[model samples]
Target: MTIIRSRDFTGGRPWAALDIASMNGIGTRLHWTDQPYIWHINEGQEVFVVLGGRVRMRYRKDGVEQAVVLAVGDIFYAEIGCEHLAEPLGEARVLVVEAVGSL
Candidate 1:
């Protein structure tokens, strides 16, 4: 068994992650980032959880753009083909669970 403190975790680069588990081809990761992620769509569904700090999440739906500010313990669910981006308010730690190799 491995125990990790999400707030204490550090990554090599923005969205850099440590693989935590993979079951039935779904993967879970712990990540750290201080920069905004590129807008893109995931081939599969994703569960984004904020473990530390804050994030401004932006997404587009039905040709309309929307955004939400997420703080610690907040979660964002991204459906397949949903275009989205995440901009961190500062150094933040996040947990992302999605299909392996999904962007």
Candidate 2:
């Protein structure tokens, strides 16, 4: 059993992650960041959960760009082929579940 205190977690740099587990080609990771991630499409589906601080999630839908602010405990699910980016509001910790090696 793995127990993590998300609030106390830190990374070496923005978007650095601690790998948690991988199951059936899917990987679960804990990430820490104080910077914005680039817009990209995931080869597979993605589940993003905010564990600490806040993040502004940006995505494109049907050629239109949209954004939402996600606070702690908020969850964001991205379908396959979804193009998105995450911008942290200061320091934040997030749990991400996605296909292994997906970007």
Candidate 3:
């Protein structure tokens, strides 16, 4: 468990971008529109830092479902095998760190 500042990790527009597999993996665009975007279960644990706009996350944790709406600087964790989904709120950005293919 670590605490990282959102400003220090982002895409440089409003925040940084990180790959779920590579810590240095930044800005890959999670936006999935114009088609059917299916949010899947996380293969492993994951974390993220909200940058611009808002991040809406829907996932399963501890036998229950959870929905998290995070604003700038907000932090989140996605447990392993937990089905999760995320999307930006009106052109939002975030710094995400997690397994190679968690969500």
Candidate 4:
């Protein structure tokens, strides 16, 4: 068992993560970031949860770009091939579950 104080969690750098678990090739991680991630498509499904602060989520759908702001407690789901990007409003913590080794 593990206990994480999400508000107090910190990483070494932007997008740095604390791995929580891995099973069956899937991984759960807690990430800290203050930078925007490059847009990319995942090879498998992804579940993103905002644990602290705010984030601007950008994505391409039907070749058009769209974006939304996610606050604490918000969740984002990405299916395989879903092109997306994440930009922190400031500093933020996010919990992500996805295929291990996926970028």
Question: By lDDT, who's the top model here?
Answer: 2
Report lDDT (CA) for all predictions.
Answer: 0.94, 0.96, 0.55, 0.95
lDDT of 1 by residue, 1-103 (tens): 9999887888888888999999999999999999999999999999999999999999999989999999999999999889999999999999999999987
Candidates 1 and 3: which is better by TM-score? 1
Query: What lDDT, from 0 to 1, does candidate 2 have?
Result: 0.96
Estimate TM-scores for all models. 0.97, 0.98, 0.57, 0.97
Clash count list over all predictions: 0, 0, 8, 0
Tell how far residue 53 is off in model 2, in angstroms: 0.4
Q: What is the lDDT of residue 100 in candidate 4?
A: 98
lDDT comparison, 1 vs 3, better candidate = 1
Q: Which ten residues in a row have the lowest lDDT in candidate 3?
A: 28-37
lDDT value, residue 31 of candidate 1: 90
lDDT per residue, candidate 2, 3-88, as tens digits?
A: 98888899999999999999999999999999999999999999999999999999999999999999999999999988999999
For model 1, the stretches where C-alpha displacement exceeds 4 angstroms are none
Candidate 1's displacement at residue 12, Å, is 2.4
**Model 2: lowest-lDDT 10 consecutive positions:** 2-11
In angstroms, give how far residue 21 of model 1 lies from its true place: 0.5
